[model samples]
Target: MQWIAALPMYNIAPALADDWRALLGAVLGRISPWLDARGDTVRIVDPGADLTAFWLRDDVLLSQTCGYPLLHALSGRVQLVATPAFDAPGCERGGYRSVLVAGAQAGASSLEACRGLRAVYNDEDSNSGMNLFRHAVAPLTSGGRFFSSATKSGGHLASLRAIAVERSADVAAIDCVTLAFVRAHRPELAAGIREIGVTASAPALPFIASKRVPKGLVDALAAALSDVIAQDEALAGRLRLRGVLRFTEADYACIDRYEREAIELGYPRLA
Candidate 1:
């Protein structure tokens, strides 16, 4: 049997291959021989791609959610295997909050003070850098006149750089995960920046498998992950995956609630 897994590339750690191998080994166990006695071929798909193609592929077994929109799109179509939100025995809930970061010299002290100031988002499809920011500021505007201007920075790291270097935007909303990654690996770039505010806590990324997969295999994989979290100290620290939690279902309706609230308040374009 063959299986495919896709992960996001944004600030991905350099130890990704080793991490995957440990994770797959723990999850697949003796079944690994059946997969490939010599080696199992794993293919990674870009998280930014329109994942509808991967979701429709019969050969793919799993994919990770990069943001809420992608998760919403896949809800009814696939089986949600595990999520950080479930707080599986070894997994912890709540990672980081999106922050409104401004240049240290800009002198803006609060969200209200930044009005009429330019803002940057990672991407239109982004949940933390886009949707949450839009929803947060929507109620403050009457006719979509919140920010002076807005643009997509393509990725969270770019959004951070845009504010730090070009000073093009007075502020930018960036995910906490990206911020932590930058601080850990590129402290120089992360310096001279301050967080003005943080968005409400939301669920973290989820690990998912297709519903078409056999239930027996799914159960075994889940058990394996739980075992690794409980017994394998090296694997746990490397993957940062605490444990396997029970899976739950959520849909576009949850996302629609936020969009609807923003639209009703007259801030439809993220201002």
Candidate 2:
């Protein structure tokens, strides 16, 4: 009955990570009572922990995972808890979109203008970074290639920096929530970065528990998340969480469809 929790997606800037982690801890703490015996000893997974591995661990009581992985990689291994509604741009009804950003110096006025340039992504498994990016450019590309070169930056913020600061890449797809957080907290990171385009929307990442957990405990986790804002609106605001909403497996099927469409269109990869 090992239990671990993590929220890696929204905690981008290091200055806010500790406070954000504490807030997450408190929200989970508030739900302790409802979890019955299962909540007695929940540990926060280290922020630096490898989330990809954490997604596969049997001890994962709660974690936030991208919609792409939830369907393709961790499909039968995890159970959905709830989807957090964000009070940020590009977020609606528990779904979010990605922004295509290019360096101001690059002088690319539009996504169409940035073709055949070096591009970076958080990871191939990322929905906002890769999947949605591919879908957005699929119809606009030729010969199944979009960029002259494609590289992996490993994280959203890093992808932003790669284009905005390092100038190593001409453009990259970034999660809207991550970009909003940076623009609000540290505008300098967004310096030289301009949003040239936006990707199609998809369900926000989901809160999940390993399938090893009992159904009763999973239900309790969902109940707690749904009532978190009501339990403590102030803390919820600090965390940028508007509310949690119910989501079904069917709600995430669109992610797989994005992949299929990309293949069918003959632009199966983002460069």
Clashes of each: 2, 0
Q: What are the candidates' C-alpha RMSDs?
A: 4.1, 1.8
**Model number with the top TM-score:** 2
Name the regions of candidate 2 deviating beyond 4 angstroms.
34-40, 47-49
**What does candidate 1's lDDT look like per residue over 104-176, in tens digits?**
7678888777788888897776777887788777877867878888989887777777788777777877766
**Pick by lDDT: which candidate is best?**
2
Q: lDDT for model 1, please.
A: 0.64
Q: Weakest 10 consecutive residues, lDDT, candidate 2?
A: 32-41
Residue 237, candidate 1: Cα error in Å is 3.9
- TM-score of structure candidate 2: 0.93
